[model samples]
Target: MAPSKTVAPANASAANVLSSVVNSYIDKTPQRTKLIDAFLGFLVLTGVLQFVYCVVAGNYPFNAFLAGFSATVGQFVLTVSLRMQSNTENKGAFEAVSPERAFADYIFGSLILHFFCINFIN
Candidate 1:
């Protein structure tokens, strides 16, 4: 008789780790929330500034612009994802996603973004 076999689902560990980390952040101090919010505002400001500078600077070094833009966008995506994944009061599809998994997804997406940016720049 053939031996019984089983395969674990991919990302099971990721889901578990993500869940725990997100839960821990719940009920954090108001100061923590304020700090996070302030940081995000800074990111938005940076993006706007960079965009304006790019427009004035012209696309002469299109490659450099692309790389810098990609890195900024990656950071933006990561910050937003962290917020969505860590919100305890958030109910709906977002609640089901673990913070760790979201982070991993954010990281993977950033890598892909960078890959394209690198090619465009070079």
Candidate 2:
């Protein structure tokens, strides 16, 4: 007869690993990074809700829905790019670009994106 292997120890090990990872992220990540992450989360939620509304409501005003969804996706992409450039870990990758410069770029890009989105809606 094969000996039975208990699942409890394995489950506990997995839980421990996950807990440690979360703790590390919370402790080591900078406040600015956390703020950016929060904005990213908001964008993701907005996009998901827009998609669900489009699907359920049939997008009668399809252009408006498209513009809103596009803006969310574009903003998310820009924010991620900014986060990557400004992150301490990526300092070497963006050696010449300071965090302030990265933020300026993000704002400029966002303005352009919104302009086009608004034009599309109109």
Top lDDT hit: 2
- Checking candidate 2 for backbone clashes, the offending pairs are none
Instruction: Score every model by TM-score.
Output: 0.56, 0.92
Tens digit of per-residue lDDT, candidate 2, span 1-122? 99998677878999999999999999999999999999999999999999998999899999999999999999999999999998999989999999999999999999999999999998
Alpha-carbon lDDT, every model:
0.74, 0.97
- Residue 46 accuracy (lDDT) in model 1: 84
Clashes of 2: 0
Instruction: Looking at model 1, report the run of 10 residues with the lowest lDDT sum.
Output: 25-34
> How do the residues 1-122 of candidate 1 rate in per-residue lDDT, one tens digit apiece?
99988866769978988888777656553554556667788888888888898899787887787788777777777777666666655647686687577768877886787777778777
Superposition-based RMSD of candidate 2 using all C-alpha atoms, in angstroms:
2.4
